[model samples]
Target chain A: MTGLKLFSRRILPQLVTLAVVVGLISIMFPGFFEISIANGRLYGSPIDILNRGAPVALLAIGMTLVIATGGIDLSVGAVMAICGAMAAWGITEGYGLGLTLLMALAAGLACGLWNGLLVAVLGIQPIVATLILMVAGRGIAQLITEGAILTFNHEGLIFFGSGSLFTIPTPIIIAIVTGALVTLIVRRSALGMLIEAIGINLRASTLAGVNTRVLLIAVYMASGLCAALAGVIAAADIRGADANNAGLWLELDAILAVVIGGTSLLGGRFSLIASLIGALIIQAVNTGILLSGFPPEFNLIIKAGIILIILVLQSPTIRTMVIFLSPAPVSQADTEKQAVNQ
Target chain B: MISKKALVGAGLLASMLMMSSSALAQTVGFSQIGSESGWRAAETTLTLQQAKERGIDLKFADAQQKQENQIKALRSFIAQGVDAILIAPVVATGWDSVLEEAKEAEIPVILLDRMVDSSDDLYLTAVGSDLVHEGSVAGQWLVDELGGKDCNVVELQGTTGSSPAIDRKNGFEQAIEGHANIKLIRSQTGDFTRTKGKEVMESFLKAEDGGKNICALYAHNDDMAVGAIQAIKEAGLKPGEDILVVSIDAVPDIFQAMAAGEANATVELTPNMAGPAFDALAAYMKDGTMPPKFIQTESKLYTQADDPQAVYEQKKDLGY
Candidate 1:
């Protein structure tokens, strides 16, 4: 596919939705997009959106591939908690940053391997397999923290959370680099196509010598690594690891990001860039809610209403209806339809 | 079988010394609602310490935040035929049958920190702090400290619609009533966690012109206060100095913040509910004196002036 066609087909819808949301927010708060540099870091609502969206964005990076492989992970949030607790425990124990991060990432990888073994090896359903970890992972995290918020004061460790390079938050930097690296690793190789083939028809792909089991396990491990990075950033942000609250309900957000990015949950085609945009959209709505000065009670209601609109706008049926109703002169929609058929 | 035989032997020994004063070496079973938080862990520690100080044999059971586990623990306590029982119930309902069984066994049950929905006769008395009064103490401290200054206070509520959150909000509003100088500029729920607390406080700081307009912040709990303290500092303003922070639940971390002059005051929801319960139990055992239906634990306020460092040192080892 040509670059322009790919951009229009995959990324345009999310960009439109994001622009609309940001526009609405700017209307509510005129200074929403105004950026100022203070304390050697970019400070603004837009910057906060990127910074706060980093965890979901990072999770969505791995989630896009997992979802593309026809698998769902409900344990990423719990894994994040466990990983954050691990990092905090290690840091407070006087361990250096490298070892602590390795320990946390290893814990995340172990959790992912457990899920992979249950699903890929034992042939369990992905949802049920991941649900086991989803329930038990928080307990494991609580155990690691000893049912208390484990706090650390290491500045080097905290830089991942609050530190900035060139006025960009470290989390934003981490998310962008990870997204770019993962995109290259998949797009520059046959891995993405293989995962998509397995998602479309596992038996056919396996018969075609695809090595489905190993690939599936590898996808889960990738997810684990992403969740670990997100967890470390979260722990560093607060300077502590709160097992009960860290990354709580964040898996749902990550999944929502993937769905909003126009990725089908049934799996097949995927785009990492689109999912990153989706993550930003979610964060924008959240930050907007905070800035809108609405009562806390209305926060969920407003979010739900806005998300419903965006989902409806992205619906294929709605797009078709729009094409029929408008019948534009240039007929870009018709060409796009032809491209999909081809 | 061994546990049963030992229990019978202990019961026989107790009966043989029925005429003794105060049931001096009495056995009591405590059903704790697991160590879900540092405060809960501290409560468990204080309960054990109280039991040891009273020379009571405390058979402890951790319910692990499950009502069924709590019920099972209470049944085992009943089977053991202990002198009395203490329960920090995980929930308010589904406890009638269990408390009835304890009553039938002639084992008076005292509740700590939380109350049950059963009829009052099921338990002797509940030892807990009045959550609203704790909020009132925190608000009263802020009000008196301001002394009619035009203060724009931001409130960080606990979980939305939780009993503590609702009661604490009401109590604080009640305390600040008629004080036109003390105005509540904004209120939001932080879900009683540090992360949400910091996030909400950051927004409050931004909306209130970078902490210049906000004079005080009242959080429903000290954990949120600690979180908001960091936010205040990050916004390039002093917490206790620029924006006074007063919160409820004097957890150990809050005292550390207080010592650093980062937090202004805190109302302590003491974890020593067992101390009062043990005292009441001792009185009842010595001379069947029926205590009141509800025993309210003191909601003490601590300020920077209260030797916060000493308080922090004292509270650090209580498992908090």
Candidate 2:
């Protein structure tokens, strides 16, 4: 009974939003849900959403934890650029595939460490702290590629971009595995509650013997690691590292996914699966717009309208109003649920 | 060994004397927008090569995409009393005061690649390719290739609301207008990047009956076309054969794709804007020949017959 209640209260909204988006796209294009085996892989609009949504989903995984601690990551996109650049440079310079990935991962970890130090040690605001890398990370990436889209023909590195495993796309595989690992590390330990405690009152949590600084740094490192993986996948997908464009402006999408997942920006409880679904919802809308045959000018306006509706529906007052407008018996039980929720 | 050294020293001295005697080599200062794109970098390289070929002394300044830095560079060029000034203004406005200063110094300024909103008399001439014309060239080639066969085309447009996206889309549509056989079935913004191009094309393929309905693919730029070509291949379709590919911008990678027969056509957005600018400047400096206010560069088209392999080899190291 508790599990059922938790699913209905915590994850139901995001799951319903994703279903509606997919259903809407199917209505717009009759062939939206048609999946078939092509080139030994599941090929369809849904797969494309998961495949294309991989980077944002992975970022959302790290972003959920950070937001759960009352922090934000503006540098993940830039860090992705840096890591992609590092991977490309390593591959071209003959460092091989394994070393190249390690190099990219190390670059991401270093960027995260720098960001963590600024926010945790120096006591800078999260936005301002990450903004430094947000501005400079691309410049550093450009330097690595020497102001060009660094292309490589290494088969090993390219496998990470678009390769499949057991008929599943590599990017989707990476996203799911990383998301699950992060979920386990956070939920299966005291880290989850500690993060929430810090968000509610940082000084109080610190006084209560939470190693706030180390935990903060670890959270940032995880975000950086996720970004690095995203960067590798982006570069691998295109078979090159485009320093100017790799994961450009995707941090906002990650934040939006977390928000749409019903995670509060003020930081508290977070659900990894909900954020992942939020990312899929965004991708479904993007793919739907492409298949709608509408003019390009209508793209952003339609997306904005849909997102506005979703947020309005996610509002607590709106939910309560919706329940009140529903059957009378349901409203009485919903008020009790709301009471428990508070 | 000493005699050999003396001979080499004498040869070097003779070359130095000859170089100094050619003091008539005009000194021109070029104020360039920063290396923002691969095309811009190629343009800079070609500009330096053009100056060298003409025995002209060129002073170059990169403004790093800032208008203030450009103004400073222009002031310094004027102070150095250069023979002429060439500027690729990053923006179209805020050049009136600087142009007035250059005009007062009696130094003729030529605009390259991009234009300024300043008065016509402020600069001698502006040299650039017609972006719309480039798009029309790509479209015209497709029309000529298909010969009125009924076809469904998919378009991968550039970044939304960008000038190139707008102008290129207009030009292509205009060229294909009144053609009953060629219909553009679907079009979407690819954000003018390879990754977005591939992703959008994937969605396009899924929407268009596994790409069987798409007879040809038109991209606003070569990068997108290159990416779309890959997507078509991944969909188990030969890009050049099944869906004819036409795009603008003759970047080196696109040439390589053409060499592999994966891409069909590209219209060149030549990076040699400085070549024509130099010619006009030379004429203006000599015998009071004032070039026209706007000099448009050629938008040459390339096909499979154009020896794309040789072209690729030539352009591979131009900093592209």
List the TM values for chain B, per candidate. 0.92, 0.93
lDDT of each: 0.89, 0.90
Itemize residue pairs with steric clashes in candidate 2.
Answer: A161-A236, A161-A237
lDDT digits (tens) for residues A81-127 of candidate 2: 99999999999999988999999999999999999999899999999
DockQ for every model, please.
Answer: 0.52, 0.65
The TM-score obtained by model 1 is 0.94
Candidate 1 C-alpha lDDT tens digits along A1-342:
698796786798899999999999989888786677767888767887898899999999989998999999999999999999999999999889999999999998998899888889999998999999999999999989988889889998889988889989899999999999999999899999999998899899999999999999989989989999999998998889999999999999999999999889998999899999999999999888887878788888999999999999988999789877885646787788899999
What is the total number of backbone clashes in candidate 2? Answer: 2
Per-residue C-alpha lDDT of model 2 across residues B191-302, encoded as one tens digit per residue: 9999999999999999999999999999999989888887887777899999999999899999989999999999999999888988988787778898889999999999
Q: Whole-model lDDT, candidate 2? A: 0.90
Q: What CA RMSD would candidate 1 show?
A: 3.8
Judged by DockQ cut-offs, the docking class of candidate 2 is medium
Segments of candidate 2 deviating more than 4 angstroms: A325-342, B1-23
